[model samples]
Target: MYPTEESDPFCLSAASATRLLTDAPWRRFASMGDSLAAGTGDPSPGYANLGWPDRLAGTLRRVRPDLAYLNAAKIGATTAKTLANQVGPVLEFGPDLIHISCGANDIWRPDPDLAEIGWNLRRIFERAAETGAQLTTFTLGSAFVVPGFPDWHDRVRALNDITRELAATHAAVLVDMWSHPVNSRPNLLSADRVHFSTSGQAVMASELVKGLVDVLRAHPVTSDRAPE
Candidate 1:
Protein backbone atom coordinates (compact mmCIF):
# COMPACT_ATOMS: atom_id res chain seq x y z
CA MET A 1 0.00 0.00 0.00
CA TYR A 2 1.14 3.58 -0.73
CA PRO A 3 2.21 5.33 2.44
CA THR A 4 -0.37 8.07 2.63
CA GLU A 5 -0.44 10.01 5.88
CA GLU A 6 -4.19 9.49 6.07
CA SER A 7 -4.08 5.70 6.16
CA ASP A 8 -0.53 4.36 6.41
CA PRO A 9 0.73 3.79 9.92
CA PHE A 10 4.27 4.28 8.63
CA CYS A 11 3.60 7.81 7.42
CA LEU A 12 3.60 10.64 9.94
CA SER A 13 0.36 12.47 10.38
CA ALA A 14 0.24 16.29 10.09
CA ALA A 15 -0.09 16.82 13.83
CA SER A 16 2.52 14.24 14.65
CA ALA A 17 5.03 15.85 12.31
CA THR A 18 4.33 19.28 13.74
CA ARG A 19 4.73 18.01 17.26
CA LEU A 20 8.02 16.39 16.35
CA LEU A 21 9.41 19.67 15.01
CA THR A 22 7.75 22.06 17.46
CA ASP A 23 11.04 23.04 18.98
CA ALA A 24 13.00 23.30 15.73
CA PRO A 25 14.90 26.57 15.51
CA TRP A 26 15.56 26.86 11.82
CA ARG A 27 13.95 29.86 10.11
CA ARG A 28 15.74 29.87 6.77
CA PHE A 29 16.07 26.52 5.04
CA ALA A 30 17.93 25.91 1.81
CA SER A 31 18.23 22.69 -0.23
CA MET A 32 20.79 22.27 -2.97
CA GLY A 33 22.40 19.76 -5.32
CA ASP A 34 20.88 17.29 -7.82
CA SER A 35 17.56 15.70 -8.66
CA LEU A 36 17.12 14.20 -5.25
CA ALA A 37 17.35 17.65 -3.71
CA ALA A 38 14.84 18.82 -6.28
CA GLY A 39 12.51 16.01 -5.24
CA THR A 40 12.36 14.61 -8.77
CA GLY A 41 9.93 11.72 -8.88
CA ASP A 42 6.60 10.46 -10.14
CA PRO A 43 3.53 11.28 -8.10
CA SER A 44 1.93 8.48 -6.16
CA PRO A 45 -1.82 8.05 -6.46
CA GLY A 46 -2.68 9.37 -3.00
CA TYR A 47 0.26 11.58 -2.03
CA ALA A 48 0.98 15.25 -2.55
CA ASN A 49 3.14 16.34 -5.50
CA LEU A 50 5.52 18.09 -3.12
CA GLY A 51 8.96 16.53 -2.98
CA TRP A 52 10.83 15.68 0.19
CA PRO A 53 12.40 19.11 0.61
CA ASP A 54 9.08 20.84 0.08
CA ARG A 55 7.40 18.43 2.43
CA LEU A 56 10.05 19.16 5.04
CA ALA A 57 9.68 22.90 4.57
CA GLY A 58 5.96 22.53 5.07
CA THR A 59 6.48 20.83 8.39
CA LEU A 60 9.05 23.39 9.43
CA ARG A 61 6.61 26.16 8.57
CA ARG A 62 4.04 24.47 10.72
CA VAL A 63 6.43 24.78 13.62
CA ARG A 64 7.51 28.27 12.66
CA PRO A 65 5.06 29.84 10.28
CA ASP A 66 7.60 32.38 9.09
CA LEU A 67 10.08 29.82 7.75
CA ALA A 68 11.99 30.87 4.68
CA TYR A 69 13.04 28.27 2.16
CA LEU A 70 14.88 27.94 -1.11
CA ASN A 71 15.28 24.77 -3.16
CA ALA A 72 18.08 25.28 -5.69
CA ALA A 73 18.45 21.75 -6.93
CA LYS A 74 18.63 20.96 -10.61
CA ILE A 75 17.96 17.67 -12.32
CA GLY A 76 21.09 15.79 -13.53
CA ALA A 77 23.45 17.95 -11.51
CA THR A 78 26.75 16.45 -10.45
CA THR A 79 28.60 17.25 -7.26
CA ALA A 80 30.94 19.55 -9.11
CA LYS A 81 28.03 21.36 -10.68
CA THR A 82 26.35 21.86 -7.34
CA LEU A 83 29.54 23.24 -5.84
CA ALA A 84 30.03 25.59 -8.75
CA ASN A 85 26.49 26.93 -9.00
CA GLN A 86 24.22 26.19 -6.08
CA VAL A 87 26.55 26.94 -3.22
CA GLY A 88 26.69 30.69 -3.79
CA PRO A 89 22.93 31.18 -3.76
CA VAL A 90 22.59 29.03 -0.66
CA LEU A 91 25.24 31.04 1.10
CA GLU A 92 23.45 34.18 0.08
CA PHE A 93 20.25 32.82 1.59
CA GLY A 94 21.95 32.60 4.97
CA PRO A 95 20.05 29.50 5.87
CA ASP A 96 20.05 28.11 9.38
CA LEU A 97 19.38 24.68 7.95
CA ILE A 98 20.69 23.18 4.71
CA HIS A 99 20.05 19.95 2.84
CA ILE A 100 22.44 18.58 0.24
CA SER A 101 21.86 15.93 -2.44
CA CYS A 102 24.48 15.26 -5.07
CA GLY A 103 26.78 12.66 -6.67
CA ALA A 104 23.98 10.50 -8.05
CA ASN A 105 24.46 11.94 -11.53
CA ASP A 106 28.20 11.59 -11.26
CA ILE A 107 28.01 7.82 -10.85
CA TRP A 108 25.41 7.27 -13.55
CA ARG A 109 28.03 6.57 -16.20
CA PRO A 110 30.62 3.84 -16.14
CA ASP A 111 34.06 4.46 -14.66
CA PRO A 112 32.95 7.28 -12.41
CA ASP A 113 35.76 9.21 -10.82
CA LEU A 114 34.88 8.41 -7.26
CA ALA A 115 37.86 10.32 -5.93
CA GLU A 116 36.90 13.53 -7.69
CA ILE A 117 33.27 13.10 -6.73
CA GLY A 118 34.31 12.70 -3.12
CA TRP A 119 36.41 15.84 -3.31
CA ASN A 120 33.53 17.91 -4.61
CA LEU A 121 31.18 16.51 -2.02
CA ARG A 122 33.62 17.34 0.76
CA ARG A 123 33.83 20.91 -0.47
CA ILE A 124 30.07 21.15 -0.59
CA PHE A 125 29.85 19.99 3.00
CA GLU A 126 32.54 22.37 4.07
CA ARG A 127 30.92 25.40 2.47
CA ALA A 128 27.51 24.55 3.88
CA ALA A 129 28.98 24.06 7.34
CA GLU A 130 30.78 27.38 7.12
CA THR A 131 27.40 29.06 7.14
CA GLY A 132 26.88 27.80 10.70
CA ALA A 133 23.83 25.93 9.44
CA GLN A 134 22.81 22.48 10.52
CA LEU A 135 23.31 20.22 7.51
CA THR A 136 21.19 17.25 6.45
CA THR A 137 21.66 14.73 3.65
CA PHE A 138 20.48 11.32 2.49
CA THR A 139 22.29 8.28 1.15
CA LEU A 140 20.98 7.03 -2.17
CA GLY A 141 18.41 4.34 -1.61
CA SER A 142 19.28 0.82 -2.76
CA ALA A 143 16.22 0.79 -4.97
CA PHE A 144 17.50 3.63 -7.19
CA VAL A 145 18.67 1.25 -9.89
CA VAL A 146 19.79 1.93 -13.42
CA PRO A 147 19.72 -0.86 -15.98
CA GLY A 148 22.67 -1.68 -18.30
CA PHE A 149 25.20 -0.49 -15.74
CA PRO A 150 26.98 -3.64 -14.68
CA ASP A 151 28.78 -2.04 -11.72
CA TRP A 152 25.89 0.17 -10.71
CA HIS A 153 25.50 -1.32 -7.26
CA ASP A 154 29.19 -1.01 -6.55
CA ARG A 155 29.24 2.56 -7.74
CA VAL A 156 26.28 3.51 -5.56
CA ARG A 157 27.85 1.78 -2.59
CA ALA A 158 31.10 3.66 -3.07
CA LEU A 159 29.32 6.99 -3.38
CA ASN A 160 27.29 6.25 -0.28
CA ASP A 161 30.50 5.50 1.60
CA ILE A 162 31.87 8.89 0.60
CA THR A 163 28.64 10.58 1.60
CA ARG A 164 28.67 8.89 4.97
CA GLU A 165 32.31 9.81 5.55
CA LEU A 166 31.73 13.46 4.70
CA ALA A 167 28.53 13.66 6.70
CA ALA A 168 30.36 12.39 9.74
CA THR A 169 33.32 14.69 9.18
CA HIS A 170 31.00 17.70 8.92
CA ALA A 171 28.52 16.60 11.59
CA ALA A 172 25.64 16.58 9.16
CA VAL A 173 22.39 14.77 9.94
CA LEU A 174 22.35 11.81 7.58
CA VAL A 175 19.47 9.63 6.56
CA ASP A 176 21.17 6.38 5.66
CA MET A 177 18.67 4.98 3.22
CA TRP A 178 21.08 2.66 1.45
CA SER A 179 19.33 -0.35 2.91
CA HIS A 180 16.16 1.14 4.40
CA PRO A 181 13.16 -1.18 4.61
CA VAL A 182 11.14 1.26 2.52
CA ASN A 183 13.28 0.40 -0.47
CA SER A 184 11.80 -3.07 -0.41
CA ARG A 185 8.36 -1.76 -1.21
CA PRO A 186 7.28 -2.51 -4.77
CA ASN A 187 6.08 1.04 -5.44
CA LEU A 188 9.23 2.77 -4.29
CA LEU A 189 10.57 3.92 -7.62
CA SER A 190 9.17 6.23 -10.24
CA ALA A 191 8.63 5.30 -13.88
CA ASP A 192 12.25 6.14 -14.72
CA ARG A 193 13.35 3.70 -12.03
CA VAL A 194 16.11 6.15 -11.14
CA HIS A 195 14.27 8.53 -8.78
CA PHE A 196 11.91 7.75 -5.93
CA SER A 197 8.17 8.03 -6.24
CA THR A 198 6.19 10.32 -3.92
CA SER A 199 5.79 7.35 -1.59
CA GLY A 200 9.54 7.21 -1.12
CA GLN A 201 9.72 11.00 -0.80
CA ALA A 202 7.16 10.82 1.99
CA VAL A 203 9.26 8.23 3.73
CA MET A 204 12.33 10.42 3.34
CA ALA A 205 10.57 13.39 4.89
CA SER A 206 9.26 11.26 7.71
CA GLU A 207 12.68 9.89 8.46
CA LEU A 208 14.24 13.31 8.34
CA VAL A 209 11.76 14.66 10.83
CA LYS A 210 12.53 11.77 13.13
CA GLY A 211 16.25 12.30 12.73
CA LEU A 212 16.01 16.00 13.58
CA VAL A 213 13.89 15.24 16.61
CA ASP A 214 16.65 12.95 17.82
CA VAL A 215 19.23 15.63 17.18
CA LEU A 216 17.21 18.10 19.22
CA ARG A 217 16.98 15.63 22.03
CA ALA A 218 20.73 15.05 22.11
CA HIS A 219 21.54 18.74 21.84
CA PRO A 220 18.79 20.86 23.30
CA VAL A 221 18.33 24.52 22.35
CA THR A 222 20.41 25.61 25.35
CA SER A 223 23.47 23.95 23.88
CA ASP A 224 25.61 25.99 21.48
CA ARG A 225 25.71 23.02 19.08
CA ALA A 226 21.96 22.69 19.03
CA PRO A 227 20.47 22.96 15.52
CA GLU A 228 19.20 26.51 15.02
Candidate 2:
Protein backbone atom coordinates (compact mmCIF):
# COMPACT_ATOMS: atom_id res chain seq x y z
CA MET A 1 0.00 0.00 0.00
CA TYR A 2 2.31 2.72 -1.19
CA PRO A 3 0.83 6.12 -0.48
CA THR A 4 0.15 8.12 -3.59
CA GLU A 5 -1.75 11.20 -4.72
CA GLU A 6 -3.77 9.22 -7.21
CA SER A 7 -7.40 9.29 -6.17
CA ASP A 8 -7.88 5.58 -5.79
CA PRO A 9 -5.54 2.74 -4.88
CA PHE A 10 -1.91 3.63 -4.65
CA CYS A 11 -1.03 0.05 -5.52
CA LEU A 12 0.21 -1.00 -8.90
CA SER A 13 -2.31 -1.56 -11.66
CA ALA A 14 -3.70 -5.06 -12.24
CA ALA A 15 -1.70 -5.28 -15.45
CA SER A 16 1.48 -4.83 -13.44
CA ALA A 17 0.44 -7.18 -10.65
CA THR A 18 2.20 -10.30 -11.91
CA ARG A 19 5.46 -8.42 -12.22
CA LEU A 20 5.09 -6.53 -8.98
CA LEU A 21 4.54 -9.07 -6.23
CA THR A 22 7.39 -11.52 -5.78
CA ASP A 23 8.15 -14.29 -3.32
CA ALA A 24 11.82 -14.57 -2.52
CA PRO A 25 14.99 -14.97 -1.24
CA TRP A 26 15.83 -13.08 -4.42
CA ARG A 27 19.04 -14.97 -5.10
CA ARG A 28 18.61 -13.97 -8.71
CA PHE A 29 19.48 -10.37 -7.97
CA ALA A 30 19.97 -7.70 -10.65
CA SER A 31 22.31 -4.67 -10.85
CA MET A 32 21.36 -1.40 -12.52
CA GLY A 33 22.98 1.99 -13.43
CA ASP A 34 25.45 3.59 -15.86
CA SER A 35 28.95 3.35 -17.34
CA LEU A 36 30.64 3.25 -13.97
CA ALA A 37 28.44 0.29 -13.21
CA ALA A 38 29.06 -1.26 -16.59
CA GLY A 39 32.73 -0.51 -16.06
CA THR A 40 32.76 1.20 -19.42
CA GLY A 41 36.15 2.39 -20.63
CA ASP A 42 37.85 0.36 -17.95
CA PRO A 43 41.10 -0.44 -19.74
CA SER A 44 41.60 -3.59 -17.73
CA PRO A 45 40.19 -7.07 -17.69
CA GLY A 46 39.59 -6.99 -13.94
CA TYR A 47 36.73 -4.52 -14.29
CA ALA A 48 35.42 -6.24 -17.39
CA ASN A 49 35.40 -9.52 -15.50
CA LEU A 50 34.65 -8.31 -11.99
CA GLY A 51 32.84 -5.04 -11.41
CA TRP A 52 31.50 -4.10 -8.00
CA PRO A 53 28.37 -6.20 -8.07
CA ASP A 54 30.45 -9.15 -9.11
CA ARG A 55 32.93 -8.45 -6.32
CA LEU A 56 30.08 -8.22 -3.87
CA ALA A 57 28.74 -11.48 -5.20
CA GLY A 58 32.16 -13.09 -4.94
CA THR A 59 32.62 -12.09 -1.32
CA LEU A 60 29.18 -13.39 -0.50
CA ARG A 61 29.83 -16.41 -2.69
CA ARG A 62 32.76 -17.25 -0.51
CA VAL A 63 29.92 -18.78 1.46
CA ARG A 64 27.40 -19.24 -1.37
CA PRO A 65 29.22 -19.00 -4.69
CA ASP A 66 26.26 -20.31 -6.61
CA LEU A 67 24.10 -17.26 -5.88
CA ALA A 68 22.52 -15.97 -9.06
CA TYR A 69 22.97 -12.33 -10.17
CA LEU A 70 22.81 -10.16 -13.26
CA ASN A 71 24.06 -6.71 -14.33
CA ALA A 72 21.80 -4.55 -16.51
CA ALA A 73 24.00 -1.48 -16.61
CA LYS A 74 24.68 0.50 -19.78
CA ILE A 75 27.30 3.04 -20.83
CA GLY A 76 26.51 6.80 -20.63
CA ALA A 77 23.23 6.27 -18.83
CA THR A 78 21.23 8.63 -16.62
CA THR A 79 18.28 8.04 -14.34
CA ALA A 80 15.84 8.30 -17.24
CA LYS A 81 17.81 5.89 -19.35
CA THR A 82 18.31 3.66 -16.37
CA LEU A 83 14.54 3.50 -15.92
CA ALA A 84 14.18 2.56 -19.54
CA ASN A 85 16.69 -0.27 -19.39
CA GLN A 86 16.07 -1.33 -15.83
CA VAL A 87 12.27 -1.24 -15.44
CA GLY A 88 11.39 -4.10 -17.73
CA PRO A 89 14.22 -6.44 -16.75
CA VAL A 90 13.74 -5.62 -13.11
CA LEU A 91 10.06 -6.48 -13.34
CA GLU A 92 10.88 -9.66 -15.19
CA PHE A 93 13.64 -10.71 -12.77
CA GLY A 94 11.77 -9.72 -9.66
CA PRO A 95 15.19 -9.68 -8.10
CA ASP A 96 15.51 -10.21 -4.36
CA LEU A 97 18.14 -7.48 -4.29
CA ILE A 98 18.83 -4.51 -6.57
CA HIS A 99 21.72 -2.00 -6.69
CA ILE A 100 21.49 1.20 -8.72
CA SER A 101 24.00 3.96 -9.70
CA CYS A 102 22.85 6.61 -12.13
CA GLY A 103 21.92 10.34 -12.49
CA ALA A 104 25.44 11.60 -13.20
CA ASN A 105 24.73 11.75 -16.90
CA ASP A 106 21.52 13.58 -16.17
CA ILE A 107 23.52 16.16 -14.30
CA TRP A 108 25.80 16.47 -17.29
CA ARG A 109 22.85 17.52 -19.41
CA PRO A 110 21.94 20.26 -16.95
CA ASP A 111 18.24 19.57 -16.94
CA PRO A 112 16.22 22.26 -15.23
CA ASP A 113 13.82 19.77 -13.75
CA LEU A 114 15.97 18.06 -11.15
CA ALA A 115 12.80 16.64 -9.69
CA GLU A 116 12.53 14.35 -12.66
CA ILE A 117 15.64 12.46 -11.60
CA GLY A 118 14.40 12.07 -8.06
CA TRP A 119 10.95 11.07 -9.25
CA ASN A 120 12.32 8.47 -11.59
CA LEU A 121 14.50 6.90 -8.93
CA ARG A 122 11.64 6.87 -6.47
CA ARG A 123 9.53 5.17 -9.07
CA ILE A 124 12.15 2.49 -9.53
CA PHE A 125 12.47 1.89 -5.82
CA GLU A 126 8.74 2.01 -5.20
CA ARG A 127 8.07 -0.47 -7.98
CA ALA A 128 10.74 -2.87 -6.74
CA ALA A 129 9.54 -2.56 -3.17
CA GLU A 130 6.16 -3.83 -4.30
CA THR A 131 7.79 -7.23 -4.36
CA GLY A 132 9.47 -6.62 -1.03
CA ALA A 133 12.90 -6.81 -2.66
CA GLN A 134 15.80 -5.18 -0.89
CA LEU A 135 17.24 -2.07 -2.53
CA THR A 136 20.64 -0.28 -2.58
CA THR A 137 21.74 2.86 -4.43
CA PHE A 138 25.10 4.46 -5.17
CA THR A 139 26.13 8.09 -5.15
CA LEU A 140 28.48 7.90 -8.12
CA GLY A 141 31.89 9.56 -8.27
CA SER A 142 32.25 13.21 -9.28
CA ALA A 143 30.96 14.60 -12.57
CA PHE A 144 33.45 17.48 -12.82
CA VAL A 145 36.16 15.13 -13.92
CA VAL A 146 33.92 13.60 -16.57
CA PRO A 147 36.04 15.39 -19.25
CA GLY A 148 33.69 17.16 -21.68
CA PHE A 149 31.15 18.02 -19.04
CA PRO A 150 32.59 20.66 -16.73
CA ASP A 151 29.35 22.21 -15.39
CA TRP A 152 28.10 18.91 -14.04
CA HIS A 153 30.05 18.72 -10.81
CA ASP A 154 27.59 20.79 -8.83
CA ARG A 155 24.65 19.10 -10.50
CA VAL A 156 26.04 15.72 -9.61
CA ARG A 157 26.24 16.79 -6.00
CA ALA A 158 22.60 17.81 -6.17
CA LEU A 159 21.64 14.45 -7.62
CA ASN A 160 23.67 12.57 -5.03
CA ASP A 161 21.99 14.46 -2.21
CA ILE A 162 18.59 13.63 -3.62
CA THR A 163 19.45 9.95 -3.89
CA ARG A 164 20.83 9.73 -0.36
CA GLU A 165 17.79 11.52 1.00
CA LEU A 166 15.49 9.13 -0.81
CA ALA A 167 17.43 6.16 0.49
CA ALA A 168 16.88 7.34 4.00
CA THR A 169 13.20 7.82 3.27
CA HIS A 170 12.75 4.36 1.76
CA ALA A 171 15.05 2.48 4.08
CA ALA A 172 17.43 1.57 1.27
CA VAL A 173 21.17 1.05 1.75
CA LEU A 174 23.39 3.65 0.07
CA VAL A 175 26.93 3.63 -1.32
CA ASP A 176 28.58 7.06 -1.37
CA MET A 177 31.40 7.17 -3.93
CA TRP A 178 31.49 10.88 -4.79
CA SER A 179 34.39 11.42 -2.38
CA HIS A 180 37.61 9.89 -1.15
CA PRO A 181 40.03 7.71 -3.14
CA VAL A 182 37.44 7.32 -5.85
CA ASN A 183 37.46 11.09 -6.23
CA SER A 184 41.01 11.72 -4.96
CA ARG A 185 42.89 8.64 -6.10
CA PRO A 186 44.55 9.53 -9.38
CA ASN A 187 45.49 5.94 -10.08
CA LEU A 188 41.86 4.89 -10.04
CA LEU A 189 40.96 6.62 -13.29
CA SER A 190 41.90 6.70 -16.93
CA ALA A 191 43.84 9.58 -18.54
CA ASP A 192 40.52 10.81 -20.01
CA ARG A 193 39.76 12.18 -16.54
CA VAL A 194 36.27 10.73 -16.78
CA HIS A 195 36.20 6.96 -17.12
CA PHE A 196 37.92 4.53 -14.84
CA SER A 197 40.87 2.31 -15.62
CA THR A 198 40.75 -1.30 -14.48
CA SER A 199 42.15 -0.66 -11.01
CA GLY A 200 39.84 2.26 -10.49
CA GLN A 201 36.85 0.17 -11.37
CA ALA A 202 38.07 -2.44 -8.91
CA VAL A 203 37.97 0.20 -6.20
CA MET A 204 34.39 0.97 -7.20
CA ALA A 205 33.63 -2.71 -7.00
CA SER A 206 34.96 -2.73 -3.44
CA GLU A 207 32.66 0.12 -2.43
CA LEU A 208 29.78 -1.63 -4.10
CA VAL A 209 30.65 -4.77 -2.16
CA LYS A 210 30.38 -2.86 1.08
CA GLY A 211 26.93 -1.59 0.15
CA LEU A 212 25.75 -5.07 -0.83
CA VAL A 213 27.13 -6.43 2.41
CA ASP A 214 25.04 -3.87 4.22
CA VAL A 215 21.94 -4.82 2.26
CA LEU A 216 22.50 -8.51 2.89
CA ARG A 217 22.95 -7.80 6.57
CA ALA A 218 19.59 -6.08 6.63
CA HIS A 219 17.71 -8.68 4.56
CA PRO A 220 19.53 -11.77 5.90
CA VAL A 221 17.57 -14.18 3.70
CA THR A 222 20.42 -15.64 1.66
CA SER A 223 22.35 -18.61 2.98
CA ASP A 224 25.76 -16.97 2.46
CA ARG A 225 25.23 -14.52 5.30
CA ALA A 226 23.72 -17.10 7.65
CA PRO A 227 24.73 -17.10 11.30
CA GLU A 228 28.52 -17.25 11.04
Error of 2 at 170 (Å): 2.2
- Candidate 1 lDDT over 1-228, as tens digits, reads 455647765578778999988888889999999999999889987888878999999999988888999999999999989999999999999999999989999998677898899899999999999998999999998886688887888998999999999889888899999988988888889998888898888889999999899889988774223366
Q: How close is candidate 2 to the true structure, as a TM-score?
A: 0.73
Residue 35 lDDT (model 1)? 92
What is the overall TM-score of model 1 with all chains considered together? 0.94
Least well predicted 10-residue stretch by lDDT in candidate 1: 219-228
Best by TM-score: 1
**Clash pairs of candidate 1?**
none
What C-alpha lDDT does candidate 2 achieve relative to the native structure? 0.62
lDDT tens string, model 2, 1-228? 212212222112222321222212446667788876565544553234445566555544444445677788888877788887777887687677777777767777644468898898887777767777677777767623655656567677788798898788777777677774445544455666677565555556555545555555555553334464
Enumerate clash totals for all models, in the order shown: 0, 2
